[model samples]
Structure formats: structure tokens, C-alpha cells
Target: MENIEHLYEEYAQTVYKYLFSLSQNADLSEELTQETFYQAMKTIHHFRGECKISVWLCQIAKHLWYNEINKKNKTRSISIDDLEIPVHTGKNVEAAVLQNEEKLALFRMLHRLDEKTKEVMYLRLSGDLSFSEIGDILGQSETWARVTFYRGKQKMMKGRSEWNSD
Candidate 1:
């Protein structure tokens, strides 16, 4: 077997990012990334090389994140009120608040979407995954993933315009 260190060096950031996308907690994601590599080392023999190594590592990270959340009895969705959007308005506190509100509204609009579209948005926006990877994960074609993401964007834009008019 090649060095596990090499594998960790190559894939740690990708696995961490995948965990972060799902958890949005840097600390938890880091811990899960380590755990993911550990688990992958243990099960490397089972990896039949059917999928990209990065994808397999992310699958491990995803499972560990879920297990961590279950242990903490936490919901997948964090409380929107507790979030602080990092949009820099500098000295303009009112502008910052408005920006945060807009981000929260976007989240709400995303939450209202159909499950498939919502998954597409989360994978595209948060996971920073490619359309092909998202399609592979979702068991759909690359074109389907691209179209779902485009449609999801359209829905969010329409919702935002409507929200602004309110």
C-alpha cells in the first residue's frame, strides 16, 4: 500500500470542504475530515475503485458528519436567527443587517424548493461540486444536474424579486 500520509495530503482539503458544506461548522468539519481518512484507511480494501477517490473520501466524510450530528442530537438545519452573514458593509451596520436579511431570505427560498432542486443547490453552492459529480451522486445525468441547478437559480431569483417588492 502507498503511504496513507500521501492520500491524506492529497484529499484532506477536499474531504474537509465536503464536510463543511454539509455542516457549515469548521471545527466539526475538520474533525470529521480526520475521521473520514481514518475510516477510509480501515476500509481501503473495500474500495473497488469504481468511483473517484475524492468522491469516495467525501462519502466517508458525509457519513461521519451525519453520525456526529446524530450524536449531538442536532438538526441538519441550523437556526437562521443565529447566523451572522459575513458580508462586509464596514461602518454601515444597517447595510450589514439588510445584507444578512437578504441572505436569510435566500435560505428560506431555498428551503421552499423541491427536494431534488434543493439538493442541486446545496451541492452546487455549498459543496462547490461539479455538475458531473452532483449528477453522479444523485444518480442523474450531468445535463440533468445542470438543468436542475439552473432552474433552482431561476426560482431563487424570482423569489428574491418578489421579496424585494414586499
Candidate 2:
């Protein structure tokens, strides 16, 4: 097997983003990201090379987050107000404000989705993984990942339309 050090350099950001998408807490994400790598290092002997390392790392992160939440026995609400939009896009002030507002609205709607669907959507959108990769990480089929994401997208669109008409 290769050095564990290289794995951190290659997959840290992806793992961090995936964990952040799940927990929506920067500090928790950071801690879990580190814990995920640590667990992987401890169990490196069991890695079968059946999937991409990134996928494996994400699976570890997912499990760690799950265990943490289950142990705490309380759901942590997503703090939309804590989300920051980057300002370097060179957009006009009005455009930036509108963009940020739209993102906030989208996130609020996303939180309304069922836990599994929301997770699929977050992994696809924020983690930037393909349906196949998501399936590997979530221990499901690619078609399942695709359909869940499609349904989630439809729910978001339907919610947005209803809001617009009200």
C-alpha cells in the first residue's frame, strides 16, 4: 500500500466538503474530516481497492457523522445565516445580493427534503460527485442515486414555483 500521508493531501478537501455538506457545521466538518482520515489509516489493511479512494474516504466520513449524530440524540439544524458567498465574482452589487438570496432560499428548501434525499442532493451538488460515485459512497445503485437526485431537484423546483406564485 502507498503512504497514508499522500491520501490526506489528495482527498482532504473532498472529504471536508462532503462532511460539511452533511453536518453544515464548519468546525464539526473539520473534526470529522480528520477523524475520517485517522480511521482510514487505522483500517488501511482492509481497503480492498474496489472503489476510488475518495469514495472510500467519503463513506468513512458519512459513517462517522452518523455515529456522532446518533450518540448526541439531537438533530443539528442547518444555519443558513452562516453560509458565506464568495465576493470575487466581479458581479454588480445588485447581482451579488440576488445571487446570495437565491442560494439561501435554495438551502432552506433543501433542508425540508427527507434525510436520504437531502443527503443525495448535497453529495451530488456540494460534494461534486457523479451518480456512480455517489452510489459507491452511499452503498446504493447508480440508478437509485440518479432517481433520488432527480426527485430532490423536482421537489426544489416545485417548492420554488409555489413560493413565486404566493
Top-lDDT candidate index = 2
User: Which tens-of-lDDT digit does each residue in 1-166 have in candidate 2?
Assistant: 3678899998888788788877878899999999999999999889999877888899899899999999777766658896876656566777978988989998998999998899899888877777876776776889999999999999999998998899
lDDT of 2 at 7: 92
Model 2: clashing residue pairs?
none
Give candidate 1 regions above 4 Å deviation. 1-3, 74-91, 129-144, 161-166
Error of 1 at 107 (Å): 0.4
Candidate 1's displacement at residue 166, Å, is 7.0
Q: Residues 1-166, candidate 1: write the lDDT tens digits.
A: 4767898998787677667778888898888888898899899889998877777887787778778879778655678887987655567878878887878887999998999899889878898877887776666789999999999999988988997899
How far does residue 8 in candidate 1 sit from its true spot (Å)? 2.8
